[model samples]
Target: MTQQTKGKASALFPLLIFILLFIGTGVLTKDFSNMPLNVAVIIAAAVAIFMNRKVKLAKKIEIFTKGAGHENIMLMCIIFVLAGAFSEVAKGMGAVDATVNLGLSLLPANLLMVGLFLIGCFISITMGTSMGTVVALTPIGIGIADQTDIPMALAMATVIGGAMFGDNLSMISDTTIASARTQNTSMSDKFKTNFFIVLPGALITALILWFITSGSHINQLEDYSYNLVKVIPYLAVLIVAILGVNVVIVLIGGIILAGAIGIIDGSYTGTTLLQAASQGVLNMEDIAIVALFIGGIIGIIQYNGGIDYLLHVVSNKIKSKKGAEFGIAGLVSVADISTANNTISIIMTGPLAKDIASKYNVDPRKSASILDIFAACWQGIVPYGGQMLAVAGLASISPISIMPYSFYPVLLGICGITAILFGFPRRKVKQ
Candidate 1:
């Protein structure tokens, strides 16, 4: 490859190696955290050096370093560290139990399950990221289950369900933007189509969750003592996030509040607070490693034109308007599973999706909705995605175990595929 052009295929080899070593090992072990992710990243980065054909040996290492050190990547790493600190510190100070009891106290015991599920949905929709919503709520959900005798899997599903709800429809969501920009459409136009299509499915999911936990016991044993004022940290984070504050600031604020509350209330010593922050940052090591390795490899792939090559190879055989649209969905869904990131899937396939949209005379809005909906649907149920990771972390359960109990994700996927086939939200072609 010339200095002006690096091929995506070659660049992507490190990513492929990482996937095989990391994800494949996790599957083989049935325990995702069995192998430390940083080790996998180190292996992948070593491979990336040899994979570079165009750039000089020195430049290849530079490319890898640059990708790993990107501003966005750095920011995410910071967020991951802060999130870890905030979560650990909060839980250590009795914040998790406090939040849980407050929720239980206000909820009707008979409808407690439904209430938790709805709250999950509400928080996700407001926040616009399934992962973010999950981090903030999953522990609380688990604590509630422990108190109320709600099944762990069933309770975990509530938060997962709600997180995906926002992921699919949030106005400022990365997936939504990726879909819209890829299809050359406005966000407002895509939302109209998506909202109508998912309405039936969302309601059905709510009903199913209600049925699953309708008889949950909310009986009183010893009422746990919780400092109501200690809950302020979580509330502050939520309010800041909802008001469009940047996520980094939100995390830092939460961390500070949690630390201060712990100290002021005698729940923790100053050194303990610092240790909690440090532990939290350490806990995110796996996630941060995954992101950096994936990004570096993906960058190489793009430089090598691997994605473009695939798109070219596939587009020739795709015939007819219907086939073209479905092909686009299939392409993006496979990418999502491979990358385990819905946002990245959309980013990779946005141009291809647009080409199909234009060639088929299909409405751009419909195409964008299809891309976002399908990716979101698959991401929701995938055991490797962030949703599962957070839920599994909270309940100490394998993601696979929760799959069967996650009626909402399964039904939403089915509902989405059916919507596509039946054209329920049929596009009205204008003359």
Candidate 2:
């Protein structure tokens, strides 16, 4: 027990070092874009290795490598690569334009803001990736802003909020998969809990958008021909994913489908298709590197006792089930803030959340929901996070500029905290 406690306490140092290095440099520079997260993570990994006095240097290196190569970490890397590939290929084939035009054709002028949000939600849910949704829809949202009276930041925020909605609830979402798998819960069970918890928030966001953007005039898609065939890949991915297909398979299928459609449509030849796919994978380099470094760092910390120490410190004040649930929410929120990736945060905190839930008899389903929701909430709003960064790049606006308009995450955070404080969705009893 003494040894275990020591390990946990020791693990925290590396994590703290990472946070300080990453967040500190960003704050000091006043430019998050200048501070590379991957570098911070690598330095933290080095600190983790140096702090491990029990093992030889070679052994420590092996441990670090093992952690980075863990099955879960590798799976996430694969997903990122495939998701990037699929998104890029689809973009190359003008799928984003097609989707944007299709959505424009269906909505009334006054409801453009709300329509953008809803479409983002649908695309994110269908794509099972918030970044992908942002990549695909941010341009469309910007176009809407240019065409209508809506502000650029407001339009982009709508896309972000909607993307987060799907990221929070989509079955194939990385956060969902991480949460359910880590908590030993079923996706459907967690979805039932998560869906209802966020439904009110989603509805409120839509209503607010409608009221705010009511005066905006809609712009017709003049001479914009949308090919419906271009949308089949997203639809296929969503359909098979909903039917319980493996996420990797779903993404791979989507990539192939999009590539085939692109080729047949004369959008690209075989060589250009490969180039697009390769570029897509390259786009994910930062995240992929961070994931690997984090895996290695976390592995060493776990080996030395970081997670156990964290669990001890986090749970020390919890007495009731509600407190335990709240602790879980706080755990993932902090993790999300530190990492700036909702899916990665979920993966990191999930095991500890499960432990807390089991000890306090908190429902696993609720735990999973809380994990995904809070992570998504924090990730959606963090200016440095991938979602916000991607949108910022596409919209040519500061990520923080979109914060006030990020109604979904704000509402999500409110609803989530309220649920924990008030103990909504009372724990179910096993028959």
Q: For model 2, name the residue pairs that clash.
A: 7-304, 7-305, 8-305, 11-306
Cα lDDT, all candidates: 0.73, 0.78
Worst 10 residues of 1 by lDDT: 1-10
Tens-digit lDDT track of model 1 for 319-427: 8877776777786776676556788788877787787778777788888988888788778876656567556654666566677677666666676677667775776
TM-score against native, each model:
0.83, 0.74
Displacement of residue 315 (Cα, Å) in model 2 is 1.3
In terms of TM-score, which candidate is strongest?
A: 1
